[model samples]
Target: MKSALYLFLLLLALQVQGQHGSKLNAQQQEQKSPHSPEDQSQAEGENSPHIKTAPSNYDFAFRFYKHVREEVGNSNIFFSPLSISTAFAMLSLGARSNTLDQLHKGLAFNLTELEEQEIHEGFQRVLQLVNDPHREVQLSMGNALFIDDRLKLLQKFLDDVTNFYYSEAISSNFQNSPEAIKEINNYIETKTHSKIAGLLKSLDPETVMVLVNYIFFKGYWEKPFNNLSTRDDDFFLDAKNSVKVKMMHQSKPFNIHRDEKISCWVVEIPYKGNAVALFVLPDEGTMKQVEDALLKETVSNWMHSFTKRKIHLDLPKFSISGSYDVKSLFEKMGVTDVFSDHADLSGMAENALLKVSKAIHKAMVDVSENGTEAAAATVMEAVPMSAEFPPPPFIRFNRPILMIIVDKVTQSILFIGKIVNPAAEED
Candidate 1:
């Protein structure tokens, strides 16, 4: 399966704090509520036999990441592939023919042999598993559909989003209500724990619908970093440029692998639950080559090649953020139909000719002595927008590095970006 357009239009922000950093965002502290539709049987339809053994498809994600990285160039990049994929998957349920084909191929799904309902069920299963309240991880995902009250949307599409994707739908008169922007922004803030704001500065009067999705995560390292050991150090941005940064130090048994072929080091840092942050540090001046060789199979091989060993590690305690407008990026990915008049979103409404007009994405990541906290939000305006290995013997992340945040259960890449400079400001 291919990755979708705007699949990685991400905003990644990292915040740095000394021994202690800002507490988890407030939205995470609230009581957990089940967002699944009230109809239990409908929501829990027989688990797809395929979902249990099906591949999570990380190849599509890696390919998408490489493309966006090349486009953004030299800047710190971070985004949640799973979040973008989920949003597009929800949108695809209402897609038809060529439009649907583009989405499926772009997202890297081979559902030719699978029933359409089965695909939705697979996503539903994964969503529930990842968001299960019992899990130790704090992952909060919220999706909203803002539609102009004048249009009548199909009940099936609404039901699928709610039951399968756990999204909430809202109605608004974008053409007449000046407050529509504020309302949507408020929802984005609340969903992303206020990490993202102003996703929609203004709404087009002709817009018939807008789709928004946000994901927030906070988790302590299975083995927390010693805040007292954190100290200021030099982080090399290149051969000649460097910046002083607070580096978090830790010594423990960790999963690691060294790929001599690519001249890089891969390490896995486990979050409190099944989630983990995989770091790939290429030998000096080899970031591009390492990235060029990245793939789902390569990553899987590296992950399985890990041998636990006691190694000292120094990682900068820095926060970073990134944002992007990815219409052009999507076009590059061959996802053009949805943005042009040729778009076919007939599944959403009876006679409405709906196509995306704008797509905006924002993300933030904060790694401190305590653990790691990150959040991402994507807004597809209808007015519309479119949207490990280890080793650790004195390994210090003093240079540019690639990072991938993943959920092991689904093997989904929640966030992927390259950090060239810890002190670099958010875009």
Candidate 2:
């Protein structure tokens, strides 16, 4: 869900349009409410014209995802779209500059300006990553003050997402006044390719919030099991009863790497796009040591230090979904407000009455012969995390484990998950 006030205001903002870097020609086009957020901004600094994001957008997004990977203990998780978008939006706010400027810092704008070829290549890279055959994955571009430019896709993405969420608040079915909720839900159902947003009904709907959903998957072995080879295998889950699971086996020599702290390998499965799933199996009896050693620096270093090797591989075809409340996440990431009525979305509309209310995210993923598949959706908790607890552990696996799904070109996470029980398919 979105902040009730921001949602309503953005709805009006979309219907009421204007060219980039220009006024809305308040005469006959759109009606203006005196108490509206936009109205207040007009009275205050009407001279300041321009929508701004922040310089730290990319770092914020990447760091947040990194946090999720390292902090969340539950296996098989999908990243939420709405949550990531909101993170960008919030990051933009603290950027102290325009969204593009913030993005420049991330994409190395200063180093290699945005050229037409770069845009084409960037989109191509993104598309290739999303359309990879091995793992089902998705990538979205969003923006702010969307006018044709180098960052149009990014801005449009956010604009599209804003409209998507605003529709939810005005739509979902509720007790006495469900008309608005119904209207919005029906409209959104048709927009997101009928993939998500079943209905817009929740406990609280008047504050800042976000909703996220996703899908993910890593493909089966190039040579699938004959059912005979997939006999009950003893999966070391704790010291208790060893769960029986069908194990997929492979003997192809692939890229394998290991150190005193960690073990990793890449297995390529023949598919439409250059598809491959990389697994990082921590050394036996050192799962805790590996996790404890985690840091953005270490992960970045590991990714940069890749070498191919030949080794037998054993993995399992599996799928999973993961969900989390991002209130605390935002707090940890240093984003407050949007949660409180004090939230100032005055740039979009009037009155300082708006507040971020609730956030919920859910993601789904699957892996099989047909190619890997995944989808994710996130809803921001206009408020903050309800519980005051530290984030839980990520995972502790001794045997083979799934690590991440990457769009080799852009190196973005289309889907990130782990399967503790390949057969169970639990989140």
Candidate 1 residues 301-390, lDDT tens each?
898899888778888876777766655666777878877777888887766777777776777888776632222012111222222353
How many residue pairs in model 1 have overlapping backbones?
Answer: 34
Off by over 4 Å in 2: 1-77, 80-87, 90-229, 263-271, 293-310, 369-402, 421-427
Model 2 TM-score, all chains together: 0.55
RMSD list, candidates in order:
10.3, 17.6
